[model samples]
Target: MNVNHSNITITESACKIADEICLPDTYLPRVVVIGGGFAGLALVEKLKHKEVQVVLIDKNNFHQFQPLFYQVATSALEPDSIVFPFRKQINGYKNVLFRLAEVEEIQPSTNTIITNKGNVHFDYLVLATGTTTNFFGMDSVESHSLGMKDIRDSLNIRHMMLQNLEQAAITCDDKERDALTNFVIVGGGPAGVEMAGALAEFCKYILPKDYPEYPSSIMNIYLIEAVGELLGAMSDKASSKTLKYLKDLKVKVLFNESVSDYDGSLVTTKSGKTILAKNLIWTAGVKGQFPKGIDEKHVVRGNRLKTNFFLMVEGYKNIFAIGDIAALISKDTPKGHPQVAQAAIQQGKWLGNSLLKIIKDKPVKPFEYKDKGSLATVGKRKAVADLGKFKFAGYFAWLLWSIVHLLSISGFRNRLMVGFNWAVSYFTYEKSNRLIIRNFKPKSLVNETEE
Candidate 1:
C-alpha cells in the first residue's frame, strides 16, 4: 500500500522480520504511541510533518468524548455524535500513521512492542494507554454492574435501562417491577453526578410519554457516594448547588455510603443498607491501563507509571508515559496531576514540543501544568463551574459547560450533531432515538452461558 501526502510517498516493503508489523521503510526515527487518547492524539498533532515517523496504536478505531458519556447512557445523545474516527483525525497528516491493535507487552530491552497483530520496533515508545474502571477487587459488583469508561458501556447502560423498563411493564409482581425501575449509580464524582441527574430527567419527562403504564414516580433514581458531598474535586458551593439540582429533579442522594456488593438486582451498601435495582452504573474510580513489561518498582498507586519532571518513565531512557497512566510524582503534585482531559492535553503538547529537543540531546525545561479550572453539569440548565476565584452555578454555568464540551469534540460534524441535539432538547424535552439495537447481558451471566 502507498500512502501519499504532499511530496512524500510511503510504500510498504518486505524488508523487515517475517513476524513484524508491516510499515513503510523510513530512515527517520520511529516514535510509537500506544493508546490514541487525549494525550496521545495531542502528541501526534505536534509531531505531524516533523522529523519523526509517528505511529499511533490503539485498540479502538475512534476517539470517544468521555464527558458526554452520561448523556449517551441516558439516551440524551446518540453514540456517533460523541465519537470521532481516528483515520478521519489523521487524514492529511502524512507523517502520522494509526494502527488498530491491542498492545499486549513491551520489550523495553529490545525497544519493541508486541501487539495482538504483530511486533513493532520503535526509536521512542510512548505509553498513553489511559485508564479502565476500577472495581477495587469486588468481583460481584464488577460483573453485575455497568461502567462508564467506554462508549460501549454507555450503550450497554442504555439498552439495559430500556430492557428493564420493558420488563417492568410486563411483570405482575410489584417487587420485581420496583427492582427493574430503580437505578443505583455509584460514586459522587462528575460522571456519577451527571448520570444521576440525567436519569432523573428521563424519569421525569421521557418515562411518562414512552411508558405510561406506570407512573413516572415508579422509577427511583439513587446516587450513592462514599463521601458526604458531590463533586468532591470541586468547590463546596458547587457541590451544594449540584445536590440541590439533583434534589429538585427528585433524585435520592445517599451520602456517606458505598456499595459493598451487587448481585444483578440487589445493591448492598457498606453501611448495611440495601437497595433493589437491576440497573447499577459504576463510575466510582479508574486505574491506569498499559501493556505489561514495566518494572513494578516504577508503578505507583492506581497502577500509574512513575515519571520524572520530563514525563520520562523512571529508570527508562527511551520509554515515556503520559496522560492518566503517567504519574509525575513531586512534592507539589504528590498524587500526580488530575486525571482530566486538559491535564492530558497539556502533557501531550508539552512532551511533543520538547521530545525532538530531548532526542537531539538538547536542553529542555521540565513540564509545568497549568490549572484551567473545572466544570460539571447536573441536568439541563444546571451546572457548576470553578474558574479560579470565580465560582458559580446555574444557567450560565450550564451554558459554559455545553459550549466547552461541544467545541472540545474532535470533528466539526460531531460538534454540529451535539449542538443540534442540545438545541432541540432545550426547546422540547425530547431526546434522540432510544432504539434498543442489541441485547445487553451482564458479564457474569454471559460468562456462565459461554462456559
Candidate 2:
C-alpha cells in the first residue's frame, strides 16, 4: 500500500508508525497478525468483514498448503497448485492489509513490532508463526540434511533428488552410484512415511522410464525412527497396516534406531550399522518459531509459548498465540493440541471470533480441538486411516485419503489440477512433470559471494 507521508514516531524508543507499513488511523482496535499459515489464514477469514483493522505480515507473499508439499517434492503435483497468493485471498476486505516483511522483534513495552521495513503499532497482537525444522542441536544434520518446511525447502529436496539421479546414471564407481541412489529419511511420523512412499514410487516407476541406465534395484530407501514403531500417535492397527504397506514397497523400515551421525557421505546408526547416503531428508520434528521479546520462561516444551484456556499468551492479555506456537493446557488436553492443520484452523477461527466478542464485551468460550481423523498413504492403492476407533487400510483408504487432501487444498483450480494429476498417475503408473525448473547446487559449490 502506497502512503504519502514517511515514518511517524509513536514513542521514545525504536517503535514508530510507518505510514507505508501501518494502515490509516482508525478508531477501531488494530490487530496485527504475524505469519500466514493455516492458523493465520483461518483467523483472517473470520475477521474479514468485522470491525477491526487487520494487518498480516509474512516473509512470503503466499499461503502454502503444507500437507501436499511432499507431492511437489516427488514431482506428483506442481508448486503453484499448493500455493495461494495472499493479496487475492483478502482482496475484498478493505480493513485487512498484507505486508511482505520479516518481523525482527516484538517490543511489548510500546505495543509495536520492529520489522525489517519499519515499526508498526498494534492494540492487539497474534502470533501464528507456526513451526520450523528442529535439528535437535545436531549441527551436522542441520548443515548437511535437506528439509521440507516451505516451498523453497521442498524444491531444494526435489532438485537435489533429481540431480543425484542424473549423477548416478553416468557414474562408473558402484559405491558412488549406490551413495547417490541411497535415500535415508529420519523420523517415522507422517512426514517421514509420506516422503518414503513418494520416493519409493519415483524409484519404482519414474526412474526406469526416465533413466534406463540405472536399474531400480540399485536404488534403496530407508526409514529410521528412534521409537519402536511408526506413527506413534495413531492407533496400533493403523500404524501396523501402514508399516506393512511400506514394507511391501521394499522400503527398509528400521525401528528403535536413531542416526548417530552423518558426515555428508556416510550414515552411522546407533545400532552400529553404516549406510552410504548422499540424500538424508530430515522429517524428524518441528518446533514453534517466533520473533524476540517473548520471555524464555513462557516458552514451554516443543518450543511453544504457554497460553491460557482463552489462547492469551502467558503473563500478557493483549498478546495471543495460536496454532503450533501455542501450548494451551486443559484438564482434557494436559499438553497443547496436536500440531495439525485442523487444530490450527480451529484455534484461529475461535480466537478471531473471541477477539470480536472481547471488543463487544460479550461472552467468549474456551478453545477446544476435535480430531476429525488422520490418514497417510504408502503407495499405489495402499494407505491407512484412523477415525476414532475405526481403523482401515488399502484401496478404499487411499480413495478417502485423496478426497480429504483434494478438499484441504486452498484453491479450486489447485484441487482440480491435483485430482487430474492423481488420475493420470493412477492409470499409467507414471509422473507427468519431472522437469527441474531451476538447477540447484550445494552451498559448497556456490561461493559465499554469489549466495
Which candidate number has the best TM-score? 1
Question: What TM-score does model 2 achieve against the real structure?
Answer: 0.94
Question: What TM-score fits each model?
Answer: 0.97, 0.94
Candidate 1 local lDDT, 66-162, one digit each (tens): 8999999999999999899999999988888888999999999999999998999999999999999999999999999999999999999999999
Predicted candidate 2 versus true structure: per-residue lDDT over 245-361, tens digit per residue: 888889999999988788778888888999899999999989889999998999999999999988999988799998999999778877789999989999999998899988778
lDDT at 385 for candidate 1? 100
Worst 10 residues of 2 by lDDT: 1-10
Clashes found in each candidate (C-alpha, N, C closer than 3 A)? 0, 0
Global lDDT of each model? Answer: 0.93, 0.87
